[model samples]
Target: MKKSVALMVGLRYTGAKKSNHFISFIALVSMIGIALGTIVLITVMSVMNGFQSELQERILGMVPHVVVGERGEGVHDWPEVEKQIVQHKDVIAAAPFIDTQAMFKARGNTRYGLVQGVLPEKEKKVSIISDYFIAGSLDNLKPKEFGIILGIGVARSLGVSMGDKVTLLIADGGTVSPAGFAPRQKRFTVVGIFEVRSEADSMITMIHMQDAAAFTRKGQLVSALRVTTNNVLDAQWTAYELRNQLDDKFYVSDWNYTHGTLFKAIKMEKTMMGVLLTLIVAVAAFNIITTLVMVVNDKQSDIAILRTLGASPATIMKIFIVQGSLNGFIGTILGVIGGVALAINLPQVVAFVEQLFGVNVIPGDVYFIGFLPSELHWDDVILITSVALSLTVLATLYPAWKASRTNPAEALRYE
Candidate 1:
């Protein structure tokens, strides 16, 4: 019954009209601060998650998960190696490729990039390049015809489009001429263009595998067998296992070797941003301490009367704890609701803002994507709420203890 009375008194005091309107205002401010902090933290974390996903899809999609190659000139028996790789349970698909670095020239403009030769039919199973074609289909890359596909950035730099002729100058197996060694130059018709809105768009080009073999004078040899896995995150383990299974002369590599540093940096940035934003919630929690301290000072006479009526120190402490906890709970609830709604619609909101202001918030040429993205996870919301509530509860303890220690005679001496 004493506990019930404590609860009732706490509830009444929280909603009761106070003599000091400034106290009420301070409490309101504290609640608003918590809510604002939560909303910003949740929204920012969701957008960061979105950026991570975009990197995985746009960048990793073009880069193979795993690659198998021989230590010599190239993979001499690529078909047999591809067959063996497909037998692995974790391997989704394998495609032969010939990779080289070359300079592309068109309309008096020259650009340097990686030139990849692929079998169009098999390439589709191991890569997403087919999905991003802005011009002709991958089927246009027929053997011996020397048809080439240019990344959008390379296409723009060369000032060429479909059906235009481009010159490829390669140093591999270059012929010795009167001017020392000369690079092999060949003309190829532009058959397709693809854009992934990533660095790959500026640095990658594709042609028929047979054409690449002829250009490099490797006959039937391929540079490597690109492999796709069921799960991209497990590609390193899969590559390791494949290495153990293959001959010592063969080497296996995964995307982690090339792009791991980039992803790690992004993850670190996300963690730092999360920690920094959490400080905002902590600052708001400090306001709870200030509000509770003032409340203890204002309720000295009431506390004395309660003590005279036989209320124990424990009950007095519980009363203030209840009041402060209620404030935190209400703020947390409001923050979660507002934060979730905003995160789920963040892209649309950004688009609306850009439209209203006539400005491009995310430029395709600058960022991996041309629009804002958001991916809200319930776990982040739960964590932020837990941290906010814990801080608020801790803030209540000192002021509640001070209120409990008020002497009846001293507190009511001038009442």
Candidate 2:
């Protein structure tokens, strides 16, 4: 019966028309603020999650998850090394590669890039490079043909296209003659172009492994063995285990060696952004304190009357707690509904806005992706709602306590 009375009184106070219009307006503002904060938090988190996912797919997909190489010039028995690498359960495939830095020149233009020598058949098993071809085919890189594949950015900078010739000047493999050192140079036909829409597009080129061995004079030796793992996140651990099993002369590396900093930076940025956005919800929750304080002041006589009529201090506190909690509950629900709807269709909404404004929000050249992506996780919504509600409940405590302390004589005296 006590609980029922508190619930009845709380519902009446919350729904009753207020004499002070300003208090009602302030309460409305608090509710709206909470809703707006939640919406922004959820949407931003979803976009950040999407960006992480896309980067993992586009960038990590193009690079080796794990690489096993010799500490010296090159791995002499790469075929045996590949066999040993694939025996690990986590490893899906392994391929031989020769990596070197070179300057590519064509049409009087030169661009510095990392050149990778790969077997077309084995490379396809370890890397997603085959999926990103803009023109030509990987099979065109026939052994002894000296065919090359250029990143789209490299081709554009060199002003070359398929069937055009490009010269690669390798400084490391230069021959020292009686007069001076001469750089090793080779001419290759541009047989393919690929675009991953990342720095790789401007920095990486590919050719046949046989040709690379001949040019580098490493003859039958490979610089490294590229490895694919069943799980990209576990590649580092897998690499460590494989290294322990390999010869002491071999060194092992994983994607983290090259891109871990980028991922860690992204994660830190997401955490900081989440903390800042959460403050908005916290501010909105604090507004509940102001709203409840005004309500307690306005209803002093009512509180005193209830005290006189045998209501306990705890009952009065319960009434105010219920009222304030309702505001938070309603706002949280509305915000979740609005945020989820917006997040799920963010791509379409972004496209529409871009079209309407005649502006490109995400430029393909500037960003790895050309579109805004959103991936809403239900856990994020639940977490935001819980935090908002907790703040709201805490904000009600002081005002409710004050109302509970109302003296019947003093409050009725004013009435």
Candidate 3:
């Protein structure tokens, strides 16, 4: 009988009755549902995280971590102050900047633009501004000289190219220039062009720092200091430290503070998506519960036979537990394989699909990068795996307990 029991429960397949094939099929559905749901959830989350990582590294790379400036007073002692600020342990680099609103006129076209003044040599280290120089180099900027770099969009709109001079109309400090308090006008040579793939790309122009000071007739003072830090997340604290170390007249601001609304929106969106997708996995887990419960109901006679043969309740629980967990194990293994494969190969897959369809699904300017970016973080994958496994364990509890409580004589008599 022991040999028979081993053969029935261990070696050979032991099921409740001949009429319970539908129960087995239902279990298969439960397993497949789990696999599909887990696959979709992990794949979608990974892609979202990858997209966020690309935005931080690329778009934020173009902008500095922090900017120190005041509303009206601007910045004073900018060069000496920048030198002192860089002495901090967290400070990486600092560059003086002249940011002002101006109107650019070229070939009967007028566009409002943001005019920024930068030092030719120092600007490259802090920002990826040099990388965007598709047409000309920052070496073209001359000290105390008027040369300008046009963005790709700005140049296209104005119908101008390198070496074409354009007029920059700036508001001089409410001074009367023989014509009762009018705006000041200056001409700049368009020596370079850059493309940042943002709104600024359409309306930004860069000139030499000294030339900008001279053109605006402002003294050696600048409008701001673009400061780079070793860690961007610490920028807000560093900004506060800068404010306290310096005078109250000066203000310090970080990227998070400057683009607070946008970053907040991204965080909120990612969180909402996570919650929504997790619901699908939960529904799949419910299917697992139903499958296990039905298996318990169908196997009552086999369970009674086992109990009559001195099988312990814990052993009885283990039997159904094994059955339910077998389902979970297979689903999790397949889901992980499928999810990781999709995450790793998403970019190539997208390219292939686009080529096959003969369409440019990802536009360079709109999305910041030329293609869909993906970076599969191992830590995120581990967390997802751990959570999924825990949910699977929870999915087996009630059904296993129900199987353990069957009455041997009553179940056999009914059978």
Candidate 4:
């Protein structure tokens, strides 16, 4: 019965039509603040998660999880190395590649880029580059014919298309002539073009392994054996394990060596954003402290009456705790509903706003991804709600204790 009385009185104190309109208004403001803070935190975190996920998918899909080769030397026994690498449980596919830097000259424009020689069918096993073909076909890049596949941006920059010939100049391989060492030059037909829509699109070109070996004078040896894993996130660790499995003289490298810093930076930014937003929730929850203090001051007479009627101090504490907790609960629930709905459809929201404003927020030429992405997590919502409620519950303790210590005689002296 005492518990029921405490709950009823506590609920009454939180009613909308309370005697003190100003105190009621303050309580409402506290709830709004909490809801706003939680909404922003959840939405922002979801967007960050989406960006990280998209980047991993796009970048890792194109780059191999691990690349194995002899340190500063081409892999002469790549077939044996590939056989060993694929034996690992995590390795999905392995392919040999020859990489070299060269300049492609076409239509009077010259652009320097990395030229990779790959066996089309074998390369398909380890890379998604073939999946992004915008023009021409990978099979057209035949061995002896010296056909080449250029990136979309590269093709656009060179103003060349299928059947057009481009001159490839390799400074490392040359024929000794009377006019000194002239760079090895070869004409290749542009057979295909692919678009990843990133910096790679402007800088990567592909040709058959036979032609690449001939151009670079590397014979049958490959620069590296690229390995793809089932899980992209495990690339770095898997590369380390592969190094140990192979001979000590062999070198192993992963995407981490080239792009790990960007990945780490994204994660750090997400964490810092989460922490900063949590402070906003904390600030909102702290408002409950001020609200409860004012409520206690307004209801001094009521507290004293309850005490005189034999109500225990613990009951008084429970009363205010319930009241403050109710406020926090409402705010947390509201925030979760709003935050989840917003986060789930954030991309659509962005598109709509962009269309309405006649502006482009994410341009394909400038950004890796052309649009905003969002992925709401239930775990984040639960954590934010729990933290806000805890702060609100704790905020009630001091004011509740002060209310419990009220003197009935002193409170009623004026009456």
TM agreement with the true structure for every prediction? 0.92, 0.91, 0.83, 0.88
TM-score rank, highest first?
1, 2, 4, 3
Global local distance difference test of model 1: 0.91
Q: Say which prediction, candidate 2 or candidate 4, comes out ahead on lDDT.
A: 2
| Model 4: per-residue Cα lDDT over 1-415, one tens digit each | 8899889989988874788888888899999998999899999999998888877876777777899998766888888988999999999999999999998899999998999999998888887788889888788878899999998878988999989999999987777898888888999999999987556777789999999998898998899998999888888889989989999889999999988898899899999999999999888888888999998888889898999999998899889988988998899889888999999989899999999999989875577666787877788878888888898888789988988888889988886
Q: How close is candidate 2 to the true structure, as a TM-score?
A: 0.91
RMSD per model, one decimal: 2.2, 2.5, 4.0, 2.9
Worst 10 residues of 4 by lDDT: 362-371
lDDT of 2: 0.91
Question: Positional deviation of 141 in candidate 2, in angstroms?
Answer: 2.2
Worst 10 residues of 2 by lDDT: 362-371
Pick out the ten consecutive residues of candidate 1 with the lowest summed lDDT: 363-372
Best by TM-score: 1
Model 4 residue runs over 4 Å out of place are 104-112, 152-170, 174-190, 195-199, 363-370
lDDT of 1 by residue, 89-149 (tens): 9999999999999999999999999999999999999989999999998999999999999
lDDT of 3 by residue, 1-415 (tens): 4434433452223233436777667767766776777777777777677667766765677677988876575677777778768977888899988878898999999888889889977788788768878888899999866889998878988899999989988886546766577777788899999876654567678999898888777777788889888887788888888878876777788998656566677678878877776667667766768877887787789889989889877777776666666677777778878888988898899999999999877665465555676667777667666766677778878887898899998899966
